[model samples]
Structure formats: C-alpha cells, structure tokens
Target chain A: MENNINDDNAPKTCEYDPNVNQDELIKAQEKQIAEEIKANTAMVGSLDGLSSLEEEYSNDPVYSSKVKTLLPKFSNVRRTRPDGNCFLRGFIFAYLEYCIHHRDELVRFKKYLESSKEELFEIGFPKFTTEDFHDMFMEVVSDLEGSGSIDRVEAVCNDAGTSDYLVVYLRLLISAHLQKNAEFFSFFIEGGRTVEEFCKQEVEPMYRECDHLHIVALTAAVGVGVRVMYLDRGEGDALVSHDFPEDKEPIIHLLYRPGHYDILYKA
Target chain B: MPMFTKLAHKTSTAAKSSGQTAAKTAAAAAAAKGNVTSPAGKHFLDNTRWQKRLQKELMSLLKEPPPGVTVDVDQAHTKLTEWVVHMEGAAGTLYEGEKFQLQFKFSPKYPFDSPEVIFVGENIPIHPHIYSNGHICLSILTEDWSPALSVQAICLSIISMLSSCKEKKRPPDNSYYVKTCSANPKKTKWWYHDDTV
Candidate 1:
C-alpha cells in the first residue's frame, strides 16, 4: 500500500531493473547490521540485570523455587536458538524478574495478560517470531491504531467464521511485549485497548458463549515471551485466564467479569 | 499379554501359509470381530509406516501412567482400538471426586498428527460445550497441534479442561450430539471467541 518513494525509504524504483547491484545489496546488509546492533544494545541492560532480578524473587523462597523451576522448562519450550543466543529466553526471564519485584504493577499487568491470552497467542506465537515477526507485529499495531484494526480484530473474533479470540490474543501479546519500544507500545495500545474494550462490552454479553475460555500470559526472561491462551469453543462464553511472571513485580492476576476486568494482587 | 503374542505369531504364520486374498479376508474378519491383534485384524489393519509409528507411541503412553489417571485397554473389541481411562482431578475442585473415561481412536496418520479422544462413562458432567460424545473443542488437538505433543499431553489437557469447568451443562441438543459429531471431528474450523466473565 506504500506509494513510490525516493532512495531514502523506498526500494529505489526497481520497476525496470531486475537484479540488485552489489552496492545496493551491501547497503541493505549494512542496514540490517545496524538494526541488529540496536536490538543487541537494548537487550544488554536486561542481560546484565538478570542476576539481581533473580535474587529479588529469592525473597519469597517457595514462589521463587516454583518460578525458578518452571521458568527454565518454559524457556526451553520457547527457545528457538541452536547456538544459545535467544532473544525470547532472555527477554522473558527479565520480564518475569520485573514482575517479581514490582508486585503491584506485576499483578495488574498479569491480570490484563491473563484475560487477554487468546488475543496474545495469535499475536505472539507460532506464526510470528524473530525478524519476520518484529515487522508483522509493528504493522498490525499500526493498522489497528490508524485503520480501526483493533475493532476489526474484535469484530472478527465475535463474528461468524472469524477466529476472534485468537486474533485478539495475538494483538495483545504483541502490544504487551513491545513495551521495549515506546512507539510500538503506543501503536499496540490503540489496537489492544480497543480490543479489550470490545471484550468488556460486546463479547461479555452472552454468558453461554463465554465459557471455557482462559488466557494466560507467560513471561520468562527466556523462551518466546508471550501470552498463551486456551479457549474452549464447546461451551458458554469463553473463560479466559493468563499467567504473568515478570522481573520487576510480584505476579498479578487479571480476572474479567461482565462489568469488571481487574488486576487482583497475586503475590 | 500372552494372548497378544500368540495373536502376532499366529498372524505371521497365517500370512506365510495363506494367499494374499485369504490373508486379507482373515484380517478383515478379525478386525470385524474386534480382535485387533488377531491375524485377520493384522492383515486388515493399516499397514503404513505411519500407522506403526502411531501404534508404538500409543503403546508407550499406555505403559506409562500420568498423575490421577488410569488407562485400560478394552480387551473385548478387536476391530476398534479403545482405551478406557479414568482421571481424578487435583483436590478441592468440582472434579476432585470425579472419574472420567476417555476413548482414543488413532487414525492412519496418528503420532504424525493427533488421535481422536472422546469422553466415555458418567464421569464428566454434561455441559453445553461438551458434546455427549465427549469430543472437546480445544486447539491443541486441532490446527495448533504439533507432532511433539504426546498422547499423555492430550490426556492431561482433557483433565485440565474438566477441572476448569465452573458450570455443569450439556449441549442444549442431546440428539444432535451423537449424530452430528462424526463429521469434522476436530471441529478445527470452530473458533472460541469469548470466555465466561
């Protein structure tokens, strides 16, 4: 949908040209390298701060053990690395640590995450990940904000034949994880907040349609840090629940009802 | 267990002695009689490599039991392979004292895909979402499924499904449940859009 642009942003008007010359290819590679360096630097603070975050959770010995034990296995499932340098793994663990220390915020975020699992899963998992995913996630967020894609996602989930909850989960997770990027966060917010509002308004209406849906957000400094949600289509309203384990806060539970989707303190 | 071996030996010997047509007929007969391990069943059973792989994996699952569950193979039926399983939920929930039976039918592409699980027995409370046939509408058994997921994982998911139910209601229509479920068994196309508040 983008119009033809000059050399700065566009692909340099290659209508007549079939092949990319050496210089252009080199420039593309350089741009890629620059982006990688930026991502690496942003992740640097998380890599160094992981130990302290782990220690903070150690204060609650039992919960700490549970988190420590479960986090690694979850990370292993989420890991896509053959050479051990995995962004999802490190990112999830860092987030979990954030949740452990900042109990109140963690609880609130966790509630939102749990309630939004079906939406998050579609946005954050299986289909989307790595480089291909980063772009797609940003695009969806932008589309939702600029083009009412948020309302559309919700409508799709609610309408006949559309995989509404799953789509919503995808958008929500993409939004939540993009916390690392302020612009992306804002874009995701426009989409995610709209979807959440729709859930509270339209989706919650028919009780029978809402059963068996649960949303859980999984946060580990390892693995594909995402919100996984399971929706049972066999029953009433889809019952949703989520799990949020972050670095700076104690995990919170976001429980939604007909009128309320609040973050319950889950220490 | 010994009968199982005898069936295998007998089937192989029959395969050697009989013509291809006879062998096929015998296998079909055994399967019709529900003697799945019988020589007749062997000839009629799916002979593809994928079927063998599925059988091996399903057997391993039968041998190792997960928590709060017991799986029993029905010795009576030979044509259809049936497992009658019972699961007890973790304490302090609606399902705590419940005992549910699940039936598994592994089609030709199982293990490489997923087996069909149906609820049997009076263990599960009838809910509007759950068909009387016990087929669930969960994603893991459908499009989101991967070969890495094992039979045990499916069983656990079912158990989890039982434990999560806050309400007890069967599908609004009882007659349609039995007749309508055979087609599109996974209900893969059905999307779960909303959750109970």
Candidate 2:
C-alpha cells in the first residue's frame, strides 16, 4: 500500500520537472524524514509499568523467562529512549533517584562531583566548558534535597538541554577516570587503542554507545556500583547480571537488551 | 592590535553588565510576571544555562585569550549570542601580518548545536577555501563541529587555515557562489573536497 503511493508520487514529480534528478530528490526527502523521526523521539521517558515488557516477550520463551524473573524483584522500569546515550541517561536517573532515597550517599556524591570538576579541568577541558556542565549538574543534584520530588526529577531529565548537559558531564567524568588511571584501564582497552584514544572515540562523543570499559570507568569515577541485568537469547533460566566496581553492592540497577539500557526499579 | 585590545576591553565591560546577574534577574522577573510571550508569541524567557555558559566563555576568553585570537561580543551590553573574533595570522606563514574577523552566532542550544561561524571584515582572506563573500568552507564550523570544540579552538583552526595557504587566491567558484549564496553561510551545503590549499 505504501509502495503504491510512493510509485504514484514518483511519476508526478517527473511530470512537474523532467530536468530534476529524481533519485537525488528522493534521497534528500528520505534523509529529511529520518531526521524528523529522530527529533520527535525523546532521549528518556517517564516512569512506566512493566506490563509493556510482558506484552513484548509474551511469545518468546527465552525473554519471557527473563521478564518473569525481573517481575518478582522489580515493579517498574523507567524507560530511557534508545538513542545510543541510554546507558549514561539510565545511570544518571537511577543514581539520582538512589540519592533521593539515601541522604548520606547524596552528600558523598556531591563532594565527589565537586572534586571531580577540578580533575576534569586538569585534564585539559577548558574551565568554561567544565564549569558550565558542572554548574548545571550541581543545580540538578541540589534540587533533589529536602522537598525534591520524583516528578521534578523526571521533568528536568526530560528537558532536552538539561538532560544533554548532564550526559556530557558524565562523559567527561568517564574520560577523566580512564585518563587519570590510564595504567589500569590501558590493560583492558582492546585493539592497541590507548585510554585517551578510546575516550575520544567512544566516551566523549554524544551518541557513542557505552561499552563495558565505559561502564567500569564511569562507575569508578562517580563512586557508585551498577548492576546491569542482561536479557538476551543466550541459554539461561535466570537473567545474567554483571556488577560494575566488582565485589560491592549495587544501588543502581539497569536492564540491558542488545543495544539499549533502561532503569530497573526494585519493589 | 591596540584597537583589538580596546575592543576586547570594551566588550568585556559590556558583557559584565548583561551577564549572569542580569540574566538571573530577568528570569526571576519573567517567572513572577507569568507566561511572558514575545511579539512573535514565542516565550520571552531567557535560557539561563546558555547565558551563563556564554558569559563564562566570554570572561575566560577575555582573561586569558589564545596567543593570536581576540574576541568581543558583536553588540555591547546586550545579547551574548553574537560574537566577533579577531585572529592574527601566525608568523612565518603566507598570511603573516594579516588580520581577519570572524562572526559567530550561537543558538540557545549552544555547545550542543554548532555556532553559525563565518569570516567578516572589509578585507577577507584570499584563500582557496574562503569565498569572496567571507563564507568559509571548513568542516569544523559545520559537519565536524563537536561540543568539545570551543571558540578558541575554532579561531585557531581559522588562523591555521590562513597560515597554510601557499598562494593567495579565492575559491574557484568564489564569484558565482558569492552572487547566488544566502546571507547566512550555514544554510549552504558546502562540499569541502579540497585539502592542500
């Protein structure tokens, strides 16, 4: 049905202007449509019930088993829009929400973040850029104090500017972590790429997908543990869980599919 | 050089007045007044984060500018969106002793969005990549722009572009493009095919 409409439109364009390069025009139109679709989708969404997951995996036994396991321990999943930056966004929202519950952890995280600013500046990030991101991050975190509500957190996280700024700051922190401890991280980096190179190629860019190396560096940098539960087709009755900052309890839980990550909230 | 310094000094003072504090007060007032819309019906509220970021950038650039770059806001004591950067051609290059001006127009979604940057001045540089009407065909100013790049880095890139030119010449299509191109070069889909200019 869609193909017939496209075919009809194609002949009409040639009729209007025979000189026009129809192929190039069609390609440009497709590109514009793709960009519009990307722009309309949010990077992160509000809290949603886990019924969607059940509906999604109802037919697939492997995924169904994973969902069944998660359903008993988790009540809700705040879905981060799968825009490549999902891991960072998921980590941030989950961590901030955790801070909202644990006051002392929030205080410690604030101090760590304050000191991390100087570390970022020392690593050759211009003071202006670092300060700008740091200030916005601090403002968002501070708002979680006292009467700060989850609704306010969701609003700010959903705001394009604030959310992107926070993501960039986290990327910087991850870069700083890897660079600061290059000797340790260099050992893990594959393909002869140095820690700095990895950060530039993988960590610094806004849309780069997060890898295990990124997860480790970020978890270490922010002084938080994250448990990523993998739900895949691999043979397993239970979901595979990998904890960052090994041997420690994780406060933040993330559900990881093939190429995306979202926050997992325990009941 | 002295004129550049004076201009920088003047702009810094102007920026101080309309910087963070002024933006905060404006935001507070807007909040109190409630739903202030512009003549165009767009919200009249300032993006405080963008204002603060630009203000900090302006302050830092003024305090410790890169070796060959001098920057000043386009308008004095007003919006921080537009900036005029002056670049001195690096010594020992074809453009040594030459000066150029670049106009940078930033959107509220700055850092995330690349600023619309173009060369501007009476005497535009005669370079293969730089058009007669001061449109620069540089990747970093367009597709290659990264949030990690700063105004200083852009100025340095432009200076280096001028410095590397062995012969002074306008782009091959300079005349035709200048006549037909839009006022804002950002709208142009520039095909940067040349490298050794």
Query: Which 10 consecutive positions of candidate 2 chain A have the poorest summed lDDT?
Result: A21-30
Q: What are the runs in model 2 whose C-alpha is more than 4 Å off?
A: A1-43, A59-62, A183-194, A235-238, B1-46, B72-79, B121-148, B160-197
Give the per-residue lDDT of model 2 (tens digit) for A120-190.
Answer: 98998777777877887887777777555666666666655567778889999999989999999899999
Q: Tell how far residue B167 is off in model 2, in angstroms.
A: 7.8
Pairs with steric clashes in candidate 2: none
Best by TM-score: 2
Model 1 over residues B2-84: C-alpha lDDT tens digits? 00000000111322222222222222222223323422123223345334444554565667767787766453134234556
TM-scores of all models? 0.32, 0.73
RMSD of 2: 10.7
How many residue pairs clash in model 1?
Answer: 90
Displacement of the residue A100 alpha carbon in candidate 1, Å = 49
**Candidate 1 vs. true structure, TM-score:** 0.32
